[model samples]
Target: MQAALQAAGQGWHVFPLRPGSKRPALHGEQSCPRTGPCVNGHLKWEQRATTDPDRIRAAWSQAPFNVGIACGPSGLVVIDLDVPKNKSKGSSDAPDGATTFKALCERAGHAVPTTYRTRTASGGRHLYFTAPPGLHLTNTAGTIAELVDTRAWGGYVVAAGSITPTGTYESLSGLQTAVLPAWLRTILQPTPKASQAPATAVLGRSNRYADVALANETRAVASAPVGEREGTLLRAARALGRFVAWGDLPRHLVEQALQEAGQAAGLTAAECRSTLRSALNWSIAHNQTRRETA
Candidate 1:
């Protein structure tokens, strides 16, 4: 009960999870009693999660339930850095989420921003950030990088004090949550449909250099060998991002062209967006510096 109250005190909506488990304790829609909280209709875990102290106290008093924080209501975007499931398998070379996220930060010329964080039972970490105002971000899995998932709207995370069969979730960094980084926000933002209009109509006929670079890079990505496709996509995005930075090409145009090429090459939409966004962010940031120096 104290665990739930503590979470609620932080303005995070809390719900009960089954004791010694991560699953929500709330009755599901199929089993809705249609009474009390569900008198009118079924309320899913997200809807039922509340910051009300009385409700929390009442709920937790019944059992030693774990606490779950509703990310959307709390205005949080949590980056979940998870470990590999089987290190002994042929996946020994697979990088963990933390490593991938760190590499991503280095690519973008930034460090991992210090913020409120929690350590999960499975030896993973949850880095919490405040969601940008007026944007309804949803959950993402393996989109930012392998084993890196995010919980936002439509998702909940186990609170710091929660415990499960594997281990306990504990607060790692008690620091205040940082606002979601702009570069990451760009990546997480939903991609609009590709434009059907000709590129020359948008960028003007004089940008031949950028036009050629875009075409060559995207074509390379499309024709890249299966094993090398991701690397090819990353390199292509980084190379073309300079054009976007120099204002020779629109960012959306670059994104759209590369996105189509990536999809054509059999890369998942999420994978393409993640790779493109990260690579472009890095190239744009550095290219701006190069331009200033030149």
Candidate 2:
């Protein structure tokens, strides 16, 4: 066993399990008791027994759920997904009980949870729920991804941002099912408001991470010399805004455009969805016109 384990790690932190002496793949099994007994152990379990009341209270305030996805000197990221209430649309609920992006197979229905580790010594756990029949992954994935981290127990999908995590299986051979119920409690301990706007850093406009294309576009508009547009500035602004809305661009970038468009462009993030709706109609009409001309 030691020989095989060492060979597998190719000389890494590999430990050989001596029948019943090893811990039960700790994280995958243990989890915040707020749910049920450790299901396939995907919640990435952790429990810090602190005697300090204030410290305990403070720690507890982070989230009723423990298990985060991170990679720091501490070996994992310690994230508290408890966003401010106002930012959450005045709801006391934390995103899917901090268990969104549950990892599962497409044909296998709902699987285990998802998780991810970050460079910032932080990680997140993605909670997976069964995708409704015929529902595309894009539909509710954004909302879920926006709410939870990707590396707690069952790391979520940070890139594809689809149904995510490919899921946590019980045994490499056997499949298991885990269900996360909705949180039903209001009047949560008061949390400080997120300053109407949480810190929004204007990341550089380099195509460093090409996947962040939407972010690049928003950076362009956000830093755009508002006066650069000629006669079609309005149209350009409108088109840009519509493009953002029609596409599932990053939320921050979408807002950046809305801010750049300014009042004259007459766009608001909340009201921007209609822009895509209108663009779709225009595209349909233009297609029909092209057919006629052809």
Model-by-model lDDT, in order? 0.82, 0.27
> What digit string (tens of lDDT, one per residue) describes model 2 on residues 1-294?
222221222211121122222222233333344353334333432232112344434443543222221111112211223233453365655544234323211111234334321221112332223322332222121212234322222222221111113222121111122222211000011112213211232223212222354344344434433222111222223333323333323434544444454333433443334333333333333322111111
Model 1, total clashes? 0
What residue runs in model 2 are displaced by over 4 Å at the alpha carbon?
Answer: 1-94, 97-99, 102-147, 150-216, 219-294
Candidate 1 local lDDT, 1-294, one digit each (tens): 887898888889999999999999999999999999899999999999999999988888899999999999999999999989986355767788899988767654468889999999988899999998898999988656778899999999999988898899999877488999876776566532223222344455436767888898899889876545666677788778877876788999999999999889888898789889977887787677323221
lDDT of model 1 at position 36:
94
Top TM-score prediction, candidate number: 1
